[model samples]
Target: MPTSNEAVKLQHDAGAAPTAAEAVRAIDGIAPTTGTARQVADGVWWIRLPVAAGPGHVNVYALQDRDGIVLVDTGTNAPQTLQALTEALCILEPNHGTIRRVVVTHHHPDHIGLAGWFAERGAEIVATRGTLAVAHRMLHDKTLSRTPEEIDFAVLAGMKDLELAAFIRRPKRRYADGVAMLPNATSVIADGETLQIGKRCWTAIVGNGHAVDHLTLCSNDGLAITGDQILPGMSTNLNVPADQPDLDPISAWRDTCRRIGEHIDERSVCLPGHHTPFTGIAIRSRQMAASQEAVVSRLLEHLQRPRTAIDCLAAIYRRTLSLAERAFLFPEAVGYMNHLANRGEIVGLRRGKTMVWQKQRRPRGDTIRREASPAISRPYNFSSEVDESR
Candidate 1:
């Protein structure tokens, strides 16, 4: 149910436990705009910037404070993108000079694209160490080649020859190309740290699974600037790339969602990176968690017999895959498999150039569940329809 942006995304967001209606309204009470600023809160303005990747747009928020304008997230680094931001700010504050602070929710290309530009102009960019570290590392490093690694992973995951050839022959330096320019964060904001942007005090709530460390800032009063951590209706991607093949974004994402739902006040209005900025975060959070768990259950059912990630794609996703869709689906396929493997719910066996996953085949009728820390542990109930004869 992720829209085009999240649907095409191989990622998605959630908030604390709130009641959600299918038809949620935008806080600004305006339709989507390419490059215009509309006031969404008492002192915060919402600006949408079109990104080339994923959903083609990112929502940039500008908060007015006594010192200057504080931005929750900045769009990419293109001339037009920068110009749009300039126009919005000029109109918001005719005498604006400096962007007092730019708090990045994560280190993605679209989000961090303009941070460097702002930072160079005396803006103090604030983000977690993970965001700051990754931005600096990916920005300066050039050889962004992952062909060899990806080819291996694809083959092992059961990609078809035509698809494999297309995937490998295509561009490989995409980790950088996915966004504009990644700007490094100057101030490393830690989780639970209270930052005084203007008159309001915002606490940093660091999350993960989507990005290693996603930052969601919650105002002391009741508002939140949640980057991609929690979109109103979409779920963030938790795909595990080959570099960190064993990592479990699923568990990490679950833990983060539950924590936010428990901590953030029920009445908070969160400003997300995409989709309409709306309330009902608490229900949306539950929706996301349930959606992810549903995927896990589907994967389990598909594993009645030994299967590879590619085999379970049809079960996890309801749509057909185009080459572009593969970019999102492949990682998602592997992520679910890896999550099962991590929890000992399944095991993998190598076959020639590929690997196949099979149910771990637990003892008699006992319902199996993932055993993790209190932050992320969840039970997985198997359907009675599953054939144990395999």
Candidate 2:
């Protein structure tokens, strides 16, 4: 774990470096899929299928047992994703008759989109209490469909109209806690709980940050099913949802990464929700930690000049965005900014409809530059020219 002193020192040192895009590209390069798999380890198999929106593909893992198979993180509920999962399951374990349970790592569409589909198939959907609570709240009230509720929620959080409207376009669904609606969810697994499937027993590790109650499963066979908790290529989004105003997701994510590093060894095969299964859990954890630290450092630089969350996002992404993309970017941008503010590296001041940020103090002799004015100011309009560059 990085101490506050160490974090501050690193933050200051990092500000003297190049832009975030340069640092990220130098570290992880471009995000690429490592392709899906059949069986990664003993009794553990993964199916990487594509989704219609955002981040393209998601991986679903199947733990084979004598009775049936237990699935971790079903892909989106789309027809193509469903068909691919069915085929993949049949190929992995043809003798298996039914999916006994579906463990949702979090409530993202790529992760839980097929929860209802699995429920229809009589597979019990399992998730952490926090995840389930948020899922239910978002789903029951049709929050995604209502524009006014979105604007109200965003404005309450000090967001602009364009930011709130971007969020309202996405479809949302709900799931309650305590295993009532999902079939065969005999019990809710808390942090550090052990679950038995067929002949194997896996330990559930509850983590927050990326998702409210992200669950990463570690089996005795040296395999850890890390849904979106840890990805091979890209950094997972640590979003500040409209529903949860007080949660500090960036801190939660960093701590969760450290906790995951402590629980799993370096050699344990990581079955992530998006990328290919690979070893080096510790390496990935450290990289994620550094990446987050780097984000904070970049935000600190942005705070040198007073800027809103949208301004910070545009500066960092450096590309035109869609409504859905802006919805994803705004919270993430604000989350990291908020993390820095909590660490006393940045300060926030509300100005009418927007919240502006500025650095607490100058770091050493680093000189800050003003952000260039955007050529196009239209909200949620990305031209084909910009799309080609992306």
- Say which candidate scores most in TM-score: 1
lDDT top scorer: 1
- Candidates in order, TM-scores: namely 0.84, 0.75
**lDDT tens string, model 1, 1-390?**
122436533232232123345534456556346656888777778888876665767888988778788888887776777777887777766654457888888878778888877777778878898887777777766764545777787888888778877776676444454444534436788988888866788878887777867888888778878788777656676766666655566767766766676556656787888767877565565566656666667688889899878888777765566775675467768877767776677888988978799888888554454444343335222222222211
CA lDDT of 229 in candidate 1? Answer: 76
User: Candidates' lDDT values, in order?
Assistant: 0.70, 0.62
Q: Which ten residues in a row have the lowest lDDT in candidate 2?
A: 372-381
Cα RMSD of all models vs. native, in order, equals 5.0, 10.9
| Residue-level lDDT for 59 in candidate 2 | 76
lDDT of 1 at 89: 78
Clashing pairs in 2: 303-359
